[model samples]
Target: MNRLALLLAGSAVLAVATITPASASTASAGEVDTVTSCGNSGLQSGLSTRLCAEVTGTTVEFYGTVGLAGPPSPGGPGPAPKELITTLSTEVVGSGAAPTQQIAHVLFTSANLQVRGSAATVPCGSTVRATFGVASFPWAPRPVAHEVVITC
Candidate 1:
């Protein structure tokens, strides 16, 4: 009877292992490529800068934010002024040396906080690459570093 019981226990353990779901092989959050800074050429106001990176076999997304530098003008009295102004935009360019097609373009507005945009189903086989840029409308006197984020 003890031998039968031991066999049953072993069989149950094997059954459980077989039924368990296997771990997925997809890439982790950190595997995606990201670019935080581009040399010393700071992004100018009213000018679009390029955020470029190579991405293969995964989707890529972009995010940005603008922070105010200082308080509003002192002369103003009627309305309290807000300092920081933020905006973000994104576009995907193919990787080939002479590629002529754009994968996607996304525009984000203040209404959409955090300015999250994404391009999915990008060419997966080769080393896919893309570039995006950001700029202010009227060029703020004290420009702040715009926070950018990316995910795959």
Candidate 2:
């Protein structure tokens, strides 16, 4: 009886030890690591844009903000704060696959508006390859996108 019990207990322990790692690996197969990137507006002065992105297993986070990059001009931010519209987007690339993308629009009212963000975090089924964060500032002549790249 003692031998049988000992053998059964040892087998159970061995089975558990082996099973645990497999389950852990299976769970982590869909896990995503932290990926971060940042971008800056191409503006010279006055109101400027700063954008960043963080990609995780379940969500892609955007940190887009508008503030004073340099000394303000004699005039205020713009003809209209409503016109101070900004666009932030992300191309999250993982495991050599096509990038999952999301975009958000933000309006900068004043320097007090610290952070503007987007709610797009489509789960990546594999490890992250890279995260590309793009910010578009509404300039006079034409709008251009500035990109920040982050690889994991």
Candidate 3:
């Protein structure tokens, strides 16, 4: 009787352990990252924003903000506050296939914004790549853009 009771208890514990639920996981709608560079002659500054992600479907969406900081003029004062230069939002589609690279749309939110050239795109994976030079400033060292690259 004692042996049978012990066996039943062990079996019950095993059953409970096996039937335990798994923890949940979270997924992002997309991912975004930024890169920035300082300006020359205190005229303009350089900034670059890059976003990449993969989705099952042909379309992907991106949203984020880009900012710039400038040092005070020579013999002036400390660095100035960071300024919000742009709020970016766009939908990109693949050229074709499981992995494709496409240049997403770009928008300038700041009234004083000045861009150099144009944005470029590169593929990183089945659903990921990078976009460069989305926006540029007149006083900045060079042109800049908020590039969005997507895969999968």
Candidate 4:
């Protein structure tokens, strides 16, 4: 009975460790890291335009805020905020490191809010703090977003 109990306990521990998600993993020496730099920068609004090429590290997170520009509510109409449909596309650039990209559809209706975004692209031997995507709503009238390239 003692032998059987110990065997079951060990099996359960192994299963639990293997099932844990990467995001849930504990931060350790070899686990989490970050790098920041100046990502793509420009003004975007009206019609449809996109900003790209920005890079940042996976471990690094960027944050920023965005506010409505131009004019205020004509008559303080409904209390509900306006909604803007925006798309975020991210991908790694160049060789030396693994390639990774992700896209997300975001809806912005808040007049002001902080954004957080991250990307990763770190070469084996390089030293520089750069920007990943800025943590600002890309749909804002005037948004200055940065990008992230994550590496360990």
In model 4, the runs with Cα more than 4 Å from the true position are: 1-43, 46-58, 62-65, 71-75, 78-80, 96-101, 118-121, 124-152
Candidate No. with top lDDT:
2
**Residue 64 Cα positional deviation in candidate 2, in Å, after optimal superposition:** 1.4
- Candidate lDDT scores, in order, read 0.39, 0.49, 0.37, 0.42
What is candidate 3's lDDT per residue for 34-147, written digit by digit as tens?
A: 433222222223433333332323333332323334333578663443333432333233645342233334444332333222233434442223232332433322222333
TM-score of every prediction relative to native? 0.30, 0.40, 0.29, 0.35
lDDT string, candidate 2, 1-152, tens digits: 99999999999999989778675656656556777666545442245555556666456566655565566556655434443434443454443545444444445445535344554545435323322232434333122233333333
Q: Model 1, range 1-152, lDDT digits (tens) per residue?
A: 99999999999999988887664445577564444442122343432233333233355444443222334447865222222343333333433345222232333322222334454445444333333334334455222222222333
lDDT for model 3 comes to: 0.37
TM-score of 1: 0.30
TM for candidate 4 is 0.35
Off by over 4 Å in 1: 1-57, 69-113, 125-137, 140-152
Clashing pairs in 2: 60-121
The digit string of per-residue lDDT tens for model 4 on 1-152 reads: 99999999999999998899867765575643433344444434422222433333333333433344344557875334434433333323444443233333344453554444464434544332322222234444443444433434
Q: 42 in model 3: Cα distance from truth in Å? A: 20
**Candidate achieving the largest TM-score:** 2
Cα shift from native, residue 119, model 1 (Å): 3.7
Model 1: how far residue 39 lies from native, Å? 9.7
In what order do the candidates fall by TM-score, top score first?
2, 4, 1, 3
